[model samples]
Target: MDLIPPPAADDAAARAEVADRADAYAAAPLLNCLLREVAEPLPRADGSGDRRVYRLPGGRPLRVRGQRRPAEPEVFTAGNWQRIGHTELVKLVVEELVRHTGLSNHELPAEMIDSRDAVAALLTARARATPPEDPYLRSEQSLLTGHPHHPAPKARGGGPVAGWLPYAPEAHARFPLALLGLREDAVVEEGDTSALDTLGEAPPGYRLLPAHPWQLDLAARDLAPAFADGRLVRLGTTDFPAWPTAAIRTLYAPGRDLFLKFSLDVRITNDIRRLWRHDLLKLRRTDSAALSAFAAIDGPAAWLSDTGYRTADFAFEELAVLVRDGLRDRVLPGATPLLAAGLVEGFDGSPLDHAPDPAAWWEAYLAQVVPPALAAFADHGVVLEAHLQNTLVAVDAGGTPVQALFRDAEGVKLLPEVSRAAGWERLVYCLVVNHLTEVAAVLADRHPGLDPWPAVRRALSRHDLPEVAALLTAPTLPGKTNLLLRWTGADGADARYLPLPNPLVET
Candidate 1:
């Protein structure tokens, strides 16, 4: 009934709405990153659950008015506590981080602001937009606040709303791919790229290449010479629209049962979304291993393989489009494959949003997801980055999770590349800390008095891996420090984590 409710009548109410909405949306992740990385939580003197407090670097007393994801920040100033909006909160982060790390960062502060502003834009745009008819697409686009642990998950490279909204999945965007023809001599491709050539006819001496228009736009300056020299020729746009997935760089074209991942020159969470040449070359090895692992699995688990890629030799990373396998082939018959991240984010048809049988649903979800990841690690030595976005779950009509599919070879760690010890640590972080913890929180939050951990423990305990026993008994798990990493200007891929209390352990 309150969808797109009228704006507040008076200026005061309107201002309050902006602050209240933006503060909660923007502050949560920032506080999550900060509290996890830098801020030290002080015990609540009154032992009140509603209001929790923390101390920043240099003993700056900081108190937030909520939990799960902290909000309504107030700093203990000269005498009493004073409330700060998102802007002041960001400033507090910068100042505290500067002192804490003994280094000043120029870009992260701007990125923090950009992320908050982006959230505001997304909130406004979503109110006016119509959600997609397909529950899968709707779920894909529902992540307004993405990567709940990242410091600037929604930041679009500090660009204005006008620049990025057209291609934003959060806006339910669907657009035509920019068609280009590369001189045959200048084209580089490996594996099954035959599907691309059929998109449209190329000139006698050229090869057809479809690109994300946004990526073409971003790489314009670097690509100007290629167009001028006639190495790259425009062939107009695709007749059918391709829907961008939750991973903004990837698009799913249902008409073709195809997924195309393009190189966008913007940072998404940890790294730039470009299909780096190094990863592109090694795709076959990683994907092959994943494919084999899934094949050996007992049940309905699947792996979405990144089969191949095509790009102009001159602009390998810029013009690259990695061809990822679509769901129709591997998805269980009579089941709908929805992105796991989308389910966690919650959309119109999220099965977990309100399950009639929370325990069974949770158990089913774990059975579908956990084993494949563990078996891949133990049997095939394939360490899956089983974080939410990289996973998909197919559900029956009754909304019970039936199958799990994992993707993203670029993130997969093969045996010998990493020691079993290191791989297990990474696996624990991605599967348990990033993926299961959030979902379990949601389940516990939604189904009151139901602790989801016991079910998770039972599910994981069944895995025969030596690590599972330790995992079930470990005191803490690795929690990635996104805020401190960014503040210290560390490489995005250089993941550093601190110990977090493991819920799997019984007191």
Candidate 2:
């Protein structure tokens, strides 16, 4: 008998641990959605101690071990509690949702499962891969369990792992862009697309077009004829590798100081991650408005403008690539720009983790982040999607936040296009609920007895907008219903929200 376990045994244990961690990672958001949307908290009649029990829509009692990231879910069945894994959790959620909504969804359960599998794949790949040296890039790639409340934040369209792994930001993936030469006549572009020409050389009659390799594979069937004809020709790949950011479809080329966002057909969170033709048509107007809004702002707050886009007329949405303003030009000097989501999710050098004075740090964060978003809405009628992923908080050498930069014109909404009430609700949801609330919760958790809400209340008090007063006094805030939205097959752009208790008022 061998005293030491074999390598195979060790490997099996490691894989099992990875799978278990993946299940926990995947279950938190699903549990959050179920509890938020359908589950009703039952009174502590039985003195359940630390365990919080909720009545499922199906009238069954379900218990969980924690809040924020709920875990160790068990259902009370036949007068006994049975622990459920990610698969069982999905089934339970599907049954409860069906009973609650009176609608059956075949797609969401698959997505939930796909999300868990994707997490397993990401964990495996991350263990073997080298994390980028740049803290910003590290921050960008840190979201292993993304969009903490979305049921399937990590889903990769249920595709094979190999199909999407090479381009996954969470896996710390970096790869060269597949360069293509598009015939001059087929090139449709707007704004300053001169940067595209600098990427690589094209023949006299052709223009250089850089494509995400994954996108190319996804659109191969649609672009076959163009490649066969003289309209499109393969020109190899870029000499340098591009770093994928938190937004999986967007890539950051460090050497060139450029961001190139490509159309991805896969469903990430609520929508198919594609650059729709409608969005492309309105890109100039929307991006220009954001640029103007940021320009008029008083502080160092900046907007990373989506300056232009280029794509083939024959396969417009399939191959469209947006040219976005890179960090070098816009970010404040002597400060490092970190993804707001990464700060919430956390990374090795996260400022939130190392803040010397959590209270002061919170104030500085609110000062940088809150003002610009409110000013944009009040002064310019440009409602920024100031959510975690869209916002970047730049910190000084001491890891204190000094500036805030917002991006993604595709999510921005102009004033009259949406009614002011609607825009204000969306803004509050994105800024307060999605961005600050998550950050505040993490901060409070890290430093116990630290009330982060007083500073938040103070921050809003400084903003004189009429909505600010009502916002502070309001009993509730609008929280988007991502799980139900996906289950009901609602349009991703159609944001339906439910009321969540207002922390500001409660505090």
Candidate 3:
């Protein structure tokens, strides 16, 4: 693997140098190319502070402290190194090394083991045999994905003709609008006796009452409160410009306060179905008191329905609804003073930043929020999505989290199927690693000296239920990795890159 020399120890000098290098590194076309090949980011230590650590996707941590004594940098205590599969690491290392060293592939080392034990032994031997001070001794790896290019498609004009309101340009590209009805200007009323009658007539091409396949069953039962309460007046769609994933989300506004999410992709749709299936089933089997307690708490008001539709490609097929107010105004944007101010910022401009106290945020979340949620699921064999977006932070009068409103029933998980095998790992990765890590990072940035792990442990304890405290102290599930690296400052100039390990695990 190609090894970049450690930056100078002088803080001021290193900062300037690292900044310059980071800009060039981020802009490098060759780096992007390499990222695409590896399917992950190049691993490096955050050089900003004393603890120079390595992080990876899914919260895997490798501590890479460099001692610049004998003229060489030695990476110490690279724990969880075995979890990433040595072969994948070797491939990434070899490719990056070839690029940096300008060496042919034929000159690189060959992989000889597939098992973790063998790979660990090999790494130990390699570390010992190599000269500690040799600049070329350490190998670093990164994945190269292709550049981001495709913009989301724009929504086609249709349904009733009303004043066109352009959505926020930067928020998203594609917009989905619910079709209410066609305007009378496009068609004439049949046997109209007056101008008013003519103006109210339904257009010829417009179906007075078109139904979404997923809503058919609910519609037949006359169970849609949004339509009855005048909440879901129209269907709205939006894209995630910031997120690279190919998902077009549609929101059904039941009221100004409630929203339903629908996606065009089957994978996401099916995942939702699996999640809800488990949740509802668990609810059915759970004690009435438990269910009632959950219902009483202010959670996201929602229900899942496919009507009769099976595919995700159909127009306006799936639907969900945001329930009416059970939460206060400060945290809920619709109810706050910031609601009217177009320029007003909400929750530090990110849902993850909604907490008042970073340390307390995790404390209340795990202790009060996650336990009831997981218990609600355990009672009925359901698993909630509980990811960042699917969850809403409901604060009390003091802005403390009294309740957690978990929405998106489609993302709920069933116990036996989801918890067993890799499903549990996937859930933990998405909810804790991917989602919670962002929140933790923001909190740590806001409040220095506060540890994020206690909060994590609290939540895990509640999820484990009767064995809560023991679970808190127990060793976390192994083989999970989260690799998140933050640049201490500007790149390539003199910046330190620290990779944080999965905080869920004890060091």
Candidate 4:
């Protein structure tokens, strides 16, 4: 497949346009973090222009143009309002965070800047590239502003643009897999990895191991010795191309009907996108629990099992690639599965964006998404990481959501493994705070005065869990502190949350 179309070939005007958009796209999430985590909202004195004012940690008043996805940031400095670009915004954020948390993070500031530059590259590449014809692939690739509240969400490990753009989902990239023949002795695998053998042929006494090209590039040096010693042999790329999904490391092969996830060794948002040894060892148990939980529930909801993984023993974590169940049998027949995040981010054909009856559409959405998540928690003690990226909403012919399919066992947390209190908090943060809140805001914004939260309340109320009543009447909900978490250098999995006003409660 042709990748990225060579970045518009030195068009100065095009470059400027790309830069301007990248700035706006990049500023929204950083501003959200600064506003939510550190900056205090100041009451409107002269309520006008849909603009809200805020006080930064340094006591300087900041004003933004919009509420959801705030833009055109301005700071009150030198006795006048000064418009700040993404660069100035990053500097202002760093300064305020230093004052607010009394901690300095040089790396995060660089990452914030890198994230913006990465956006510029993506915008440039996307302009020259043709989007996928498949609406599912289009939804999978259309997350320009990911993780709405994450600081530096687009940072590609501060690597050169050329290094990552070819494989970037945002760039609508599709490429064939680089097949490797692993010596029988060097093969380290677990669970059902049978799907891998169908990718290509391997010589006698060797197993076929399909490798992600980007990962191979990232780990070439370390594996050089093994290749030289004949423990690994290159067998060339796959005939059919695999499209990279929203998760950069995971690629979907439509022809083969399989999903492959690899360790990227890049810091995307929070963690280093690596399939850690610890997580790999416990994959079967966690995935089995999720499978059992979903099987017990009688609904259109499904769990895309992380079937198994394969890797070289010498480069276990570095070359580890996970096999995930595809959308063939999991999704409801005749329904198209779209990434939930793409709905919030606004894709080309998102059902959420063009719903004729917004109210009914929202209720259908709530019905499909809410039940399975709550059932898993209440009935099976399985807390799914039902965040936007992990959830897929399959829409019927009328573009109404009919089913919800969840993935990523690596993020799943079992009940007995963690305290109920801790599991509940994590669930609330992932499901209610991260996922529902953003989708609700978008639905409300698109169709004004059509409240989405009431349907959400009704959906939660239908579930008879003890937590449901308390959740409905709760004063606040737990919101993950992504900015603070990164600032304090906390582990990505070690989530810390702050209380945000609960929208589930009836006013």
Among these predicted structures, which one has the highest TM-score?
4
Models sorted by lDDT, best on top: 2, 4, 1, 3
Please provide, for model 1 over 1-507, each residue's C-alpha lDDT reduced to its tens digit, 9 standing for 90 to 100.
012333456767655666568667888888888888888889884533477888888798788765556778888878777889889988988888888889998988888888887877777667777778988788788897788888788889977667788888987778888899899999899888887976788888999999998888788999999999999999998888888899999999988888999999997776788899998999889989988998998888999998889998889999999888988998999999888888777898788865899999999999999989989988999999999999988899999999998999989999989898888899999999999998888887787889999999999989777789988898999999988788777888888989998999987
The regions of model 2 sitting more than 4 angstroms off are: 1-10, 45-47
TM-score for candidate 3, please give it.
Answer: 0.43
State the C-alpha lDDT per candidate: 0.86, 0.91, 0.32, 0.91
If both were scored by TM-score, which would come out higher, candidate 3 or candidate 4? 4
Give the lowest summed-lDDT range of ten residues in model 1. Answer: 1-10
lDDT of 4 by residue, 224-250 (tens): 999999999999999999999999999
lDDT by residue for model 3 (1-507), tens: 112223346766654544433222222222222232222433455442443343323333433222210111122335422322224443544544444445544311221111122212222222223221211001000001011100001111211111111111112112333333322232222221131121122345432222223333323344355446442333222221111111223233212322223322222111222212223333333323333445554444222221111111111223321112222321444322111011111222332345556566567545544554555554555555555444544444454544444444344455565454333444454455435554565456566797777667756764545444433444543222111000111211121222233466566
Per-residue error (Å), model 2, residue 432? 0.8
Per-residue CA lDDT of candidate 2, range 1-507, in tens? 001121255588888988999999999999998998888899754646688899998899999988778999988889788899999999999998899899999999999999999998888878777889999999999999899889999999999888888889998899999999999999999888888889999988999999999999998998999989889999999999899999999999999999999999889999898999999888888899989988999999999999899999998999899999999988889999999999988898888767889999999999999999999999999999999999999999999999999999999999899999999999999999999999998988889889999899999899898999999999999989999999999999999999998999954
* Clash pairs, model 2 backbone: none
The runs of at least 3 residues in candidate 4 whose Cα sits more than 4 Å from the true structure, single-residue gaps closed, are 1-10, 46-48
How do the predictions measure up, each by TM-score?
A: 0.96, 0.97, 0.43, 0.98
TM-score, structure 2 vs. true: 0.97
